[model samples]
Target: MWPADIEATARAIIADFTARGLKVATAESCTGGLIAAALTEIAGSSSVVDRGFVTYSNEAKIEMLGVEAATLAAHGAVSRETAAEMAKGALARSGADLAIAVTGIAGPSGGSAEKPVGLVHLAAAGRRGKFVHREMRYGDIGRDAVRLATVRTALGLLGEISQEP
Candidate 1:
């Protein structure tokens, strides 16, 4: 039940990872499990997708992905630090060779002067200390649009890390 571009991206990732004999995992917050869901929606994704963590809360992020409480306290869950930690944690916890994490505020509400609605942070971690991060401010976009954009960005990150030499 995904859009054509997302489905195509997922299919491409599946093929790429399958060819490379690599697996991937996801740690998600505001986008829930949509990143993983997109990957798994492709046929034969089980060969590449190891697991997905739907860590939608601070507690869940700490427990499921081993995000540090102090990091959350200092930087909050939507920060780059938390997203990086979640990616690292997912890589550590799963059998995958690479992991992607996303944390964001996707809403018609929850806007503040600092972190407004549609603000998203994403990170990707790979074996051999490969890591990458991105922050996007979609700016008061509807929740669905923000979430979908985050999923697209996350999938792109996964593809990028997998292709790294």
Candidate 2:
């Protein structure tokens, strides 16, 4: 089952974007299609959400979102560079005014010494070339928590983009 607050936040984001005449898209990795699912749970989300890309694998990220293989090799799939490229590619591939990308290691076993579990990289890109990225180290918050947090943050980013000039 989905988080309870996610639906509320998704509705708010959809309302804000629809009011402002902005269309939104998502490029998701660790969270799979949860963000898209949350947004689509709202009744009028179709007016604001143009598309969603569930690029859960490096190959899928490369093929669907045009993420560079060099970038993936250099910084792995959970880096800011990859997230930015994912957001940019999503925006370019969709008819949305803004796009959000999420990539992370949300697991109980993928934790390394350097990049532990719950190290999420998020990015938001706009058609006007404006881009914003954030690196979140949520520690070993479990897979479910990490994915829920990522979805919440992604919706917040969409809300923030709606308020931008």
Candidate 3:
């Protein structure tokens, strides 16, 4: 995912959100703060980026994003349920108009028969009852690559959410 054009996508997303007068927040797991970093790379992103949470651990997700312990225990952090909850929690916690959450296994070790490495779950939640979720199989790209892909997907989700009616 590193080689992806993530910065360009993030810039476009920031421009769209700014144009729409929307504030954004991020809850990140496998990608850490890469999505936030990408957004802040733009000069005036402060107007749109409310905050970012790098909830790399289950406890942090529960504590910071209000992801329920039962959700994590039942579906694991990489599931769509966790991602959706994370997005909603970020929105509630930061008071942002829009939020994106990403959780994934970007690893050389975490791959299993069912949930393999590079399996990323992404979700976006907006104030207007807009919800978007996606599962991506990037196919064991390196950790940096997978994380970069996840960031790109997250930013793209923000862009799409801003366009929703």
Better of 1 and 2 by lDDT: 1
Give the number of the best model, judged by TM-score.
1
- Candidate 2, residue 154: lDDT: 86
Those runs of model 3 whose alpha carbons end farther than 4 Å from true positions after fitting are 1-4
**TM per prediction:** 0.98, 0.96, 0.95
- Which 10 consecutive residues of model 3 have the lowest summed lDDT? 1-10
Q: Give lDDT tens digits, candidate 2, residues 57-142.
A: 89999999999999999999989999999999999899999999999999987879888998999999999878888899988989
lDDT tens digits, residue span 95-152, model 3: 6999999999999888898899999999999988999999999989799888877877
Pull out the clashing pairs in model 2: none
- Model 2, which residues run further than 4 Å from truth? none
- Number of backbone clashes in candidate 3: 1
* Residue 90, model 3: Cα distance from true site in angstroms: 0.2
